[model samples]
Target: MKAKNGLNYESNPKHTPGGQGFRPNAGIEPVNSFELFGESVSVNLKDKIHKSRYTMDNKGNIHRFSPDNRGNYHWSGSTADKIKLNIPN
Candidate 1:
C-alpha cells in the first residue's frame, strides 16, 4: 500500500517460510513513514508523536525500531549513531 513517505511499503508477494520479507497481511510498514524532526531536536518530544509510527508489538512480536522514533531505525549495532545516519541521501 502507499505510505506517508511515498513508498510501496507492501508485504512480500512471495512469502517464503524462512524469508525476512514483509508480511503485508497488515498495513504498511513504519520505516516507509516520514521523518518529522532532526537530530538537533530531542527524542522526548518526538516520542509523543503519533501517526508516524507504523510498526506494532502485540503479544510477543516486535517490529523494527527507529531510534528517536523517527523513520530511520538501525538494526542493533548497525551503526554507532542513529542521528548521523540521516545524512541526506
Candidate 2:
C-alpha cells in the first residue's frame, strides 16, 4: 500500500507510435501537491557563472514536475516528509 500523506504512488506508461512492448512509467510523483513554484538565478563564483533555481510546492518543499500536452501529472518524490517534487513527464 502507498502512503496517504507522503510519497504517493503512480503508474505511467511509455509507448511508441504503434502498439509495442511497453516500459514502466518513468513519470511518478515523489510528492503530493501539484502546485509548484519556479525561479531562476545566476551566481558568480571565481569569475565563473552558476545557474540555480528555487522550486517550491504549494505546501512548501522543493518541486520537480513536467506536464504533457494533455496536462496530465505524475510524480516520484515525497510530499510530507523527504519533500521533493518529482512530477511526471
Candidate 3:
C-alpha cells in the first residue's frame, strides 16, 4: 500500500512450523514531513535531540515524540501526527 505522503511499501512474511504465517514489517525509507497547522513540517532525523525522542531540523524546528509502549516510536506534534508509513499487503 502507498502512504498518504506517496511512499510505497513492501511486504515481508514469516512462516511458522504449521501452515500459519505472520508478517512484521517496517517502512523502507524514512518519512520526512508531517501535516501540521494545515501545512507540512519537516523532521530532521539526523539532528535527533534525545536519541529518537525528538527530531530537529536545521532551523531548530522540533518534532516531539514518544514510545508506543511497544518497540516503535510515535510522533505527536500534529493533527495527522503519526508517521506517514506505507503498509504493504
Candidate 4:
C-alpha cells in the first residue's frame, strides 16, 4: 500500500516488533533549526514510525515531536503556528 505522500507501506522490512519502522524512501535529513520562544532550537525530525518522542536540552526545556492524523510530523514549543513536515513519498 502506498500513503498519500507516496511512501510504500506494503511489506516494509524495516518494520520492527516495537512498531517502529524506518522510511527508507524518505531519505534522512539533517537536523532542522527553528526559532522557538525567541531562541534557536535544533529539532531532529526524521522519518520513522508514527510515535511520540520527547527531548530536552541542557536548559531543561522539553520538546515534543509527533505525527498527526495525516501522518505529517510536527514539533511543539515553536512560536510559529504549526511546523508541519510532509516527507515526500
Q: What is the TM-score of each candidate against the true structure?
A: 0.22, 0.24, 0.29, 0.28
Of models 3 and 4, which has the larger lDDT? 4
- Expressed as tens digits, the lDDT of each residue in 1-89 for candidate 1 is 33344432333322223446534332233232222111112223345643222232333222332343433432211112232222111
lDDT of 4 at 75: 42
Best by TM-score: 3
* TM-score of model 3 vs. true structure: 0.29
Model 4 lDDT vs. the true structure?
Answer: 0.35
Per-residue accuracy of model 4 over 1-89 as CA lDDT, tens digit each: 33333432222222222335654433222233122212322344555443543444455545444445674444433212133233322
State candidate 2's TM-score.
Answer: 0.24
Residues 1-89, candidate 2: write the lDDT tens digits.
Answer: 13232322233333221224344432233323333312312245567653222245555655433234453433333334343334322
Q: Which model, 1 or 3, shows the larger TM-score?
A: 3
Runs in model 1 with CA error above 4 Å? Answer: 4-6, 16-54, 64-89
- Candidate 4 residue-wise lDDT at 5: 34
Q: Rank the candidates by TM-score, best first.
A: 3, 4, 2, 1
Between prediction 2 and prediction 3, which has the larger lDDT? 2
For each candidate, the alpha-carbon lDDT, in order, equals 0.29, 0.34, 0.33, 0.35
- CA error at residue 77 for candidate 1, angstroms: 18
Q: Which sections of candidate 4 miss by over 4 Å?
A: 1-50, 78-89
